[model samples]
Structures are given as C-alpha cells and as structure tokens.
Target: MADETPGFELPLLLFAGFRTLIDQLHAELARQGHPDVRPAYGFALQAIGRGGATASELGRLLGVSKQAAGKTVDRLVALGYAVRADDPADARRKVIRLTPHGVDALARSAAIFEELRAQWATALGPGRLRALEADLRAVAPLAGVRLDVPGWFGG
Candidate 1:
C-alpha cells in the first residue's frame, strides 16, 4: 500500500525510513558504550578504515570542505580515534589511520549494525526486506546517491 499523501515520491519515503533507522541506530550505539561518536564520525571511521587517506581525500569522500574535514580530523585525533602521520610516499603529505581503540570501536559499531539489520529483517520479514534492498540497490545509481556515506542524511 502506498503512503497517505497523494503523489508522495519514493525518495521522500526512503528518506524518512533512513532517517528513522539512523536515529535509532545512533541511540543504540550510545547505549552500547559509544556515546562520543556521532553519525558523521562513523563515516570518517569508515573512510579511514579503508586503508588510509589524506585530509584532502577525506574531504572529497565526506563531501565537505577541506576546512570542515580538517576540523573533523582534529576532533578524531583529539579523541584518540585517529592519528595524523606523514605519508610515506610523500613526506609533505599526511594520512589518517585509526588507532587500536578506533579499530575496536569500528568493530563494535559493525556488530551493532548487523544486529540492527537482523532486527529489521525480523520485523519486515525476510522476503520483503530482501526485495526492498534489491529495489533500493537498483534505483540507487539512478538517484546519484553515494552508498558509503551513512551520515549523509544526518549531517
């Protein structure tokens, strides 16, 4: 069945669902002993976890200005979640790497995400959930949305 509003689009529906999911997930994460991290920080962790990246690269990945990205890096570094080290390839350049604590946090967050997904599956039913996922994946590219940025809606 469609939503109540006449001519309500698919994107808006998806946005509402996604917003709710992320808000709940963030609450769950805070309850799970990760109160310091926001969704934006999570995105930074994911980006940095894929090997390492320079501040400029992270800026691009995060769809933020270089200054904003730098501030984010500063926050992460201050919190001991990431480190800024000189890039081996270019001494003048710096790369961000997650610390052991950051690594552990990422692992924990991933587990929480899986748990949440399972809960969704249970609520929505396996077949319907799978179809929803497949349909979203099919239409995702048409919308020019970036799949990797969990904080896109929140930030």
Candidate 2:
C-alpha cells in the first residue's frame, strides 16, 4: 500500500518492519543477560566485526551522527567489547575492530538472532517468511535500496 499523501511505498514499510524486528531481537538479547546489547551496539559490533573501518565509517554505516556514533563506541569500549587502533593507511584516524571479547559477544548475539528468526518462522510459517524475504529482495535493486547492513549495505 502506498501512502496517500507522502507517497510511502512497500520498501519503506518493509524497512520499518525489518528495523522493528532488529529492535525486538536486541531487546530479547539484552533480557537474556546481555544488558549492554542494543540496536546501535549491534551496528557497531558488526562494523568492527568486519575489520578495518574507522569510527566515522561506522557512524555512517549506523546512520547515526558522528558524535552519537563515537558515544556508542565509547560505551562498547568501556564494556571491553571493542577497541580503537591507529589506522595503518591514515595515521590521523583510528580504525575500530572487535576484541576477542567482542567477537565472543557477537557470537552470542548471533545465536540470539538465529533463535528469534526460528521463532518468527514458527509463528509465520517458514514458507511465508521466505516468500516475504524474497519479495523484498526482488524489488531492492530497482529501488536503489540495499537492506544488507554489512559494510555500507554490502556496496
């Protein structure tokens, strides 16, 4: 359904739903003894998990202001989930990467994500969920959208 006035489309609705799912999953993970885990932290963790990305880059990836992004990193750093290293190519900037601890945390978070996906499938039926995902993927390229959140939306 398209928006009557502002012209919202299927992609926007799909994206909103996807974000809600992530948020809910994060909340569940936090409830499961990962009080530090949040949606923003997940973005940070994924960026660092990818290797060789600066704080600014992570910020861009997370769609957060640089200051907000820095705060997220700082929080994660304080929690020992991430670390900053001097960038080899650009001495002026630092690249963020996962510590071993961070990697372990990400692994735990990933397990939670899998569990949630399974739960969703059980509720919605795997066939329906797969079809929905396929429909989203089919229109992604035509709309200049990339739902993939890895490394600049996998660009």
Candidate 3:
C-alpha cells in the first residue's frame, strides 16, 4: 500500500503533541496556584536561570530584542514570578531573578511534565514511548532544543 500522508503532516503532528502537553501543563499549573504563568514565561524563566540574567543577556539567550525581554521581565515582576535586583557585580546593571513563587512554579512544572510523560507511556506502552523518544532524538538536532522558541516563533 502506498503511503498517502503529506510531508507537512509530520511537523504539524509534532507541534500538536507539544501543544497538548503545554495546555495540560498550564491547566495543572493554574490549579496549583500559578494561574497566570504563560508559556513564554516558562521560556523566559529558564533563560533567566538560577544565576539570573540582565535584560540584555536574557535578550541574547532568548533570541529576542532587549525591549521584548524587558517587557517580559515587566510582566514577570507584575505577576510576582520575578524581581529586578541590582546586579552585585556591576552597580549600573539590573538582573532578573526568579522569586520563590517562580521557583515553586518551576518545580511543579517539572513534576507535572513527568506525570504527563508517564501518562503517555501508559497510553502508548512504555517501549513504544521510549522508542518514539529515541526516534525523535535521532532526527532532531540535540543542540537545537533551546529556550528561544518564543522568539523563534516571532512572539
């Protein structure tokens, strides 16, 4: 039998799967007291990391303009997920650091992602799920799994 699936369906299906996981993650996050955590915030938080980053540094890491990174930082501060602190190394610069609430949200997000993966393992069978992951890793550039997706998508 000839295969009829279009070439474009592969990327679409992969994106759809990603969307499903993110939607489910956010729903759980809302129930766990982070109702305002958006997907972009997650990426920005990751880029900020434990050591934190200045707006310019974050912009470079996230592949966005400094202005865009500043706007995101503003939102994060407003949402209580992050705070702008005077950089210890340089008095003229400010760094964006995740708050306790942000740390808690990131921890919860990690746990939730594991739970979701387990659910997928149950649905697809453990071996199949592992194989799927392996297959993806084989084809997908490992180095390309980055935190700049929001900017890459022009968000």
lDDT of 2 by residue, 1-155 (tens): 87575556766876787787888777876776667776657767876675746767777766666786788888988988888898889799988888877887788778877887888799999999899778767866546642135435434
User: Can you rank all candidates by lDDT, best first?
Assistant: 3, 1, 2
Pairs that collide in candidate 1 are none
Give lDDT tens digits, candidate 1, residues 42-69.
8888878858888888888887867878
Q: Backbone clash tally for model 2?
A: 0
- Regions more than 4 Å wrong, model 3: none
Residue 85 in candidate 1, Cα distance off native in Å: 0.9
Question: Which candidate's lDDT is highest?
Answer: 3
Error of 1 at 7 (Å): 3.7
Over all chains combined, what TM-score does candidate 2 have?
0.70
lDDT of each: 0.81, 0.74, 0.94
Candidate 3 minimal-lDDT segment of 10 residues = 141-150
Cα shift from native, residue 70, model 2 (Å): 2.0
